[model samples]
Structures are given as structure tokens and as C-alpha cells.
Target: MTAAEGQSGTTGAREDERPALLRMRAITKTFPGVRALENVDLDVRPGEIHAVCGENGAGKSTLMKVVSGVHPHGSYEGEMLFDGEPVAFRDIRASERRGVVIIHQELALVPYLSLAENIFLGNENSHRGVISWNETMRRAGELLRRVGLPDPPRTRVADIGVGRQQLVEIAKALSKHVRLLVLDEPTAALNDEDSRNLLELIKQLRDEGITCILISHKLNEIRRVADRVTVLRDGRTIETLTVRENPGDEPQLSEERIIRGMVGRDLDQRFPSRSRYEGADAGELALRVTGWTVRHPIDQQRRVVEDASLTVRRGEIVGLAGLMGAGRTELAMSLFGRSYGRYEAGSVHVSGEEVTTRTVTDAVSHGIAYVTEDRKTYGLNLIDSINRNVSLPSLSSLARRGVVDAHAERRVAERFRASMNIKAPTVAEHVGRLSGGNQQKVVLSKWIHADPQILILDEPTRGIDVGAKFEIYTVIDQLAARGKAVLFISSELPELLGMCDRIYTMAAGRVTGEIDRADATQESLMRRMTVDRS
Candidate 1:
């Protein structure tokens, strides 16, 4: 829809939810090649943590961007009513002028700068461009304290870990004198301890009378912090439920209930896997890492991946379990060709032969494939066609004299598209147009095309709906069944227990403990994580 049509469609959406602090009517957005949002409606009260829940591509982020002026007033088709008044935000700055602020999942923080500088980076408090550093630091410290950080504002963003970086982002939001706050997948990347802290912070913000619109894939956090919840699917609003009032007699909202509203149907399998990992112990180790110690690129003194040694045998599945940023991805990336950071010391062996992993090509030649956690950024080329992305990892093999063999590439992509069940109009469809679950399947197809002896998947089932998670698990099980080694990393411990033959725990950049699938429990892993917390 064009901007003029969107404006016309915004009529009557704010009537039913009036006396509401904010009302959104028939909001719709269209990208170059995708209809992101369609006829969506939302309302927010003064002091409620209104949650918007959906599958990764359920149009939650696009809706939020439309409301916050990221899409601009003239860009989307809709009417935004704030404080019972129709408002048009030309840009994010204009939204902020009305005390609206959004903190995205991938935080916008300058790593090299101090917390104070980041807090007031572009929107600085100054007179005629002349800065007041001392005043900025003082206010920044106060904002951090308000968010329960209690840290010095002078701390560099790069110095602290991801959990602390999140806190800094929250502090930055509070600095805007925000009345309405939007957070997209805020704790999707946080551990239990840090996740609780961020939730508590949200509750605190609610008590202070801030209207919050939280967009998250984690329903547990929504059940905890939000009083009212809204579910979106296929660019439409799927009934807003008062979770507290309805579930008042009950303890918590069940996954079945959430899935029912999400997909408009009952889903049987939550974490679906066709089969379990079972193999002979005598099999060869396809990939092995010995005494690997990796340091933080910026801090240098702080190690992210400690002296961690692990092995993936042929036809076996090994799961890596840890809190967010406990070095799960670090291990996967550094080992799958050292794509993460500057290495201190490590040795990678393939087929019992120690090999140097200095470049991506070196790692590829060694029969290794890594599917990154952030699919949008690292996994696939979003702008290209599905055939292109699926063929990228194995393009050289499907080429004739450095020129891409288009026919061969299509055959390869077509084969995996059927095998991996990637949903799209055609192989010629751009990856950017596909849904999140479908896009993730495309990434899996890309890796499978590479035909690596060992495969490492990081957060493979994240943000996907119940029906899709099972599909991905089945694919992983198939890989192990075919005598290929698989390395799985996930935050959900139950998944690790159910799918893996063995699981390893890492903390403070070191391998702290290991557990067999038969013997592992949630308590066992929790104990190991806090072993050296003191």
C-alpha cells in the first residue's frame, strides 16, 4: 500500500480502544519486494507492559518500526494516535521528541566509546555543539543507576560482556525521557540470570508509569512481565489476551495455548526430532579441537573461549549448552575457520591430522560447515535469490573456470530445497522475501550443499514456531543418521538433553563440566554454570 492509502486505512482503528493512551489503526507497510505489515491494529494503556508475540517473521518488528517513525509518517499506511491525538512521526528523532524510544536486539552501541558517550552519542545535550563531558557523565551514571546497573559511566562498552552491554542500552533509553518504549527481542540473547535482571528492569519501568511495547520470541518472559499480550501472525492481529486476568486461577500459560493462538491450530510437536543420536564408539573423529584458548579482541586480557577441547565423531551428535555468551557461538565460529576473533592458541584436527585454520577457505577445505545464530546478518545473503544463497558455500565446485555454473547451482539448490523443505515461491525467489523459518531452512540447505563431514549449528530453532522447530530437529537427526558428525549449540537445556548423545558446559571461557544424555538434568547444568560465580 502507498502512504496515501495507508492514511485512508487508519480510520476506525482507534475508536474501540479509546480512553486508551495510544491507539494504532490499520497499520500496513510494504518493502521493495515484501508486504511486511497488513491492516494491523494495536492499543496501549499508560502503565502496562503490552507484549507483541509472534514467530520471527510474524510482522512484529515491521509493525514496531512503522509506529516508531523508522518507516516515517508518509511511508506506511496507518494512523497513530498518541494521548488521544493523531500524530505523524517524520523520523526517529521526531518520535523521540514525543518521548518514544526503541532499543533493538542488536544494540546500537559504539564499542570503542565509554557508556556516557554512547548514552548521548547523536542526541547530545549541548549548546551550539559545544559539549559538556562532566555533565553527560553525571547524567549517564544516574541513568545507569536507575536501571540498577550501579556502574561507573566511564566504563567502555567493549570492556563489559553482552549482558552488561544490554544494561547500557536500557540506560540509553531511559536517558531520552521516554514515555513509550519499544524493545525487540530484548532478552533473546541473554542467559537466565541476565534475563531475569532485564525483566525486572522492565517491570520497574512499568511501575514508573512508562508505556512499554515489548516484541519478543520468548513467551516465558512475556508471561512474567506483561499484564496484557498481543499475538500477531501473517501480518495481522491475533486477538489480544489479558494473560494475568485469564490465567489468574492458573499458574502459567501453557505452550499449547500460545501455539494455538499463534498458528490458529493445535501443534503436537514442540521440539520435534525424528530420531535420537546413537552411534558406535569406535567411529573416527571427523573434527577435533584441542587446548583451544581464544581471547577477546578488544579486552585481550579477558578470554571468551577458554582452554576448551571437544570432538565430533563420525555419525554422532554433540551438544554444547551454556547461558547466552558462555562461548557457545565462539567455539563454533572459531573452530569453523576462526571467523570470530583474534586467536591466542588452538589446534584443529580433521581426520586425525592437525591443520591450520587461518582463513575461511582453509576451514572449508577441511570438511567443516558452520550455520551462524544470526541468520539475517551472517548466515545468508538476504538480497540474493534462494538458489544463490544455497549455492554460495559450494559455488567453486559448481563452477566451470571461475564462472558460476547456473544450471548446476539450480540443481543443487533445488535438491536441498526439497530435502530441507524450504518454503518459497521458486528457487529464483530472493531470500529476503521468505519468512524467518523458511529463511533459516535455506541456511540449512546452504550448509548441507557444502557436504561437510561435520556440521555445527548455533541456535538453530530460535524464534521459530513449534511446528518448524520439529522440522529442523529432524534434519539434524538425519545428518547424524547419514554418518555425518553434528555439533549442536542451544540455550534450551531440554533440547540438548533430548537430542544429544553427550553435552558439554562452558563458563568464563572454559569447559567447566560435561554430562551424558542419560545422566544430565537442568539442575546439573545450572550448578555447573554457577560453580565459579563467586
Candidate 2:
């Protein structure tokens, strides 16, 4: 349908009169010992931005996969209707052939390929078995322009940032002549500016008569872009709310209402209650890094960190806030036994005693632990069971004569699983099969089980839902209450403001400013985080 047709067909119409471009009827899906979705129904109108909001493990992703044919026809019990025609697809390629495209959270583009090559990866422009490079580049350039990306077609995907890669994904979708686009967690890894740009691009797509289905955990983003929202809870459809259905008395949907539908209760407060530490009278010093400097591992002339110094006091949570690639993770990893960049110079002190942790084992032995940002790569062994992942760090304590006691390991893993509220069938379940939130809890459990007095958490709540974030915050609070020093690093400023006793902003490998909780504001922190390095 053209833009004019879409507007005139459904504009100012009653809810019953408007036509649904897509309908998922009586959908039900199941896994072993799990009913992922139970008789759910959804209706999405043409040219409208429809949002799917739910907590993690709520079956939102499954529904989209079913729609896009990732689950394939006859794999699940459901009927999908597109544009008044019943359709069943056997694979993703079949769905794409009918103009139904899905951009997964983890982008599918090959990093080594050029933007043009990645855009037309499988669907290349060819004439009589000959690939047409000119046609591909021209079409790729047009799609990039439509998505508002300024990068050239020849640019490599690996050389660009994540925000730009997301645009490339959208351009790739457009190349398929997508009539209905489904985006799963599109802005989960993007910063504020990139997220805004992406949302604007979605709106532009909507204006051009393309229908969109957005699955997001951030309620605020959904509210900003969605014309209607479908809320799911525990694999069931709770409600579908229109943005302007009520017409005037009040706004049709609010963030509070969506969250209530998601969590099945009024949150009242997004963050759990916690006591803030006062400066100078907070507590004794627990971990301190003084005169730290690190050079790039590959680039000997470049400095990753220079004379960086920070401290985490007992019973206090200190935050490190910075933009992407501001060297926060590098500093944290370098401090934890020089695990990252080459250590040029540094001094680490734990409880007033200088410590030399030249290796990961030495760092762990010195009562220091690091929960890495990339949990899948550096934190958890995905092929192993949760019990093993949680017990791996503390095996010595559960071992006798260098042989691990199986019963003792299970006991410790079960205890941490219960205490951390990890939602899994059993501690023996593979970590790879668990949800993102559960995997993070396992990582934390592994580090906490090691009995580290100084814990460094990098992006602890990165890809989880709001409820899971609150639970992790509670865990951090309990740790601080137990007199364990926490060095928290995050790209989210609001999280830092809510949980930290004090905030240190970094930019271009240098600490720009430090503000106490009482004095910190988003503006102040952003100013510090984006200071001109030149």
C-alpha cells in the first residue's frame, strides 16, 4: 500500500473498522518441560508502529520468530494471516520472499564484509548468473540514505560503531523490500543519541507505509515510538493499548501502566531502597588504585589509561560512568591483575597493603574479582552447567586433596542460585540455555563465591529487563551492606545516579570529574563524560 492509501484507509476510523495487516491467532508454543506461549493473539494494523513489551522470558522473541518463520510452519500451533491471506512459511527465506523481515538483536551481518556486500549478502543483484557490483552499490547507497546513515557503501562493518551497524541492519531489511519489519531489542546496546536516531528512522519507515513490530524492554522507548503496544506476561497476552485510543481525557497509555502489565504489580519505585554513603565518614578504605598507566597491547605508542587513580571504600558503591570506549573496562581489567592492556605502571592497594597481582590467579588470591562486561565470552563457560560455572572459581574451597567434592560443589551452587534468585530448573542446567538475566546471576555467583572483598562489576545489568535489574541492584546493596567494596561501571547515567555513593566520569582515558550522589545530575555527568579531549 502507498502512504496515501494507508493514511486514508485507516485514518480516524473506529477500532473495529481499521484493518489488521497482520494477525496471529491462538498461538501456542512449547519447549521441553516449558509452555513458552499459550494461546496468545495479536493484531497489528498497516503502517503503524506496533510494540511488544514484556519481561525477559515472556515469549516476545518466540512470537516474532514464529511470525518470521524461524520456527517454521507446522513447528508450533498457530495461524498467521498477512494482508487478509493465510500464509505459512517453511523458513526465514520463504518469509523474506513475501516481504516479512526480522532483524535480530545480535546483528547477522558479517563483520569482515563491506556495507554493500553485507546488505545484499544472500540476495545479491545479478544478471544471467553474473553479480552486478554497480547495481548493488547503487541500491545499497539508496537504502543507507533512506536509513539516514552517512557511511559509504565501501565502508567495512568491523570499522564502524554499533549504532551505525544497526542502521546497516535496517538498510539490509529495506533491500529485501520489507513490507513488515520486525526489530528485536533494536536499541538495547545503543547509546542515547543512537537510540534516538534509530527511533526516528523507524518513524520515517512508518510514514513511508511500512509496518513495524518493535520488541523492546525499555518502556520509555516504546512509549516514544509506538502507536500501539501489546503487553505480554508469562507467555500470555495481557493487553493491547493504543497510544491515542481514548481521544482526550487523558493519555491512552503510560509507562506505569505498561510496567504493571509486565510485572503483574505496581512497581511504585523503579529502584529498590538503599542507603547512600557519606563522604569522609563512609567507611575504611577497601581497594585503591594509584598512579595507574596502561599502554595499548598492540599499539605500543598509544596509551589506553594514564595515571588513573580511584578507590572503593568498604560498605560503599563507587560508580565509573563514561561513554562507549572511554576506557572504563580497560581500567577495571587492568587493575584486576593487568588482564587487559599492557601495564605500563600502577599500584593496587587492598586494605592499606600494596598488592602485586600479575595474573588472574594472583588477583583472585588477593581478594579481588571482576565480573566482565562480555559475560558470554569472558565470564561464563557456556558449554558447562550452571553449577560448574558457579563453582569453578571457588573449587579449591570445595576440594580435598586436589579432587573436587561433587556434593560440596552442588551445595554451594544451589545456595547461590537460591540466594541470587536465579530462575532455572536446576543448578545442573547448562548456562547457555538460561535467560540473559539468569546467566548474569550465575556470573555474579561465581565471583561472589570466590569470597572477593573487592568486586568490580562492569555493565552488570546490561541486557536484562527492569525486574531483573532491580534484583541485581538488591544484590549489590546487600554486598555493600556486608562491607564488600563494589566498583560499578556502566554506560547508563541514571543507574549510576540511583545506586552509587559517588560518581567518577571518564573521557578519553582520563577522569574528568567526580561528584557525590547528592551533587550528581545527568547534565553534570554528561558534561564530564563528553569533555573535549583534543
Q: Could you tell me how far off, in angstroms, the CA of residue 20 lies in candidate 1 after the best superposition?
A: 1.5
lDDT of 2 by residue, 165-195 (tens): 8889989988888999999988766667667
Candidate 2: pairs in clash = none
Instruction: Kindly report which residue pairs in candidate 1 clash with one another.
Output: 6-77, 6-78, 306-509
TM-score of 1: 0.88
Q: What global local distance difference test value does model 2 have?
A: 0.85
Top-scoring candidate (TM-score)? 2
Task: Give stretches of model 2 more than 4 Å off.
Answer: 1-13, 109-116, 125-167, 245-251, 275-282, 295-302
Which ranges of candidate 1 are over 4 A from the true structure?
Answer: 1-18, 148-152, 155-163, 246-252, 274-283, 299-302, 341-346, 414-438
CA lDDT of 69 in candidate 1? Answer: 86
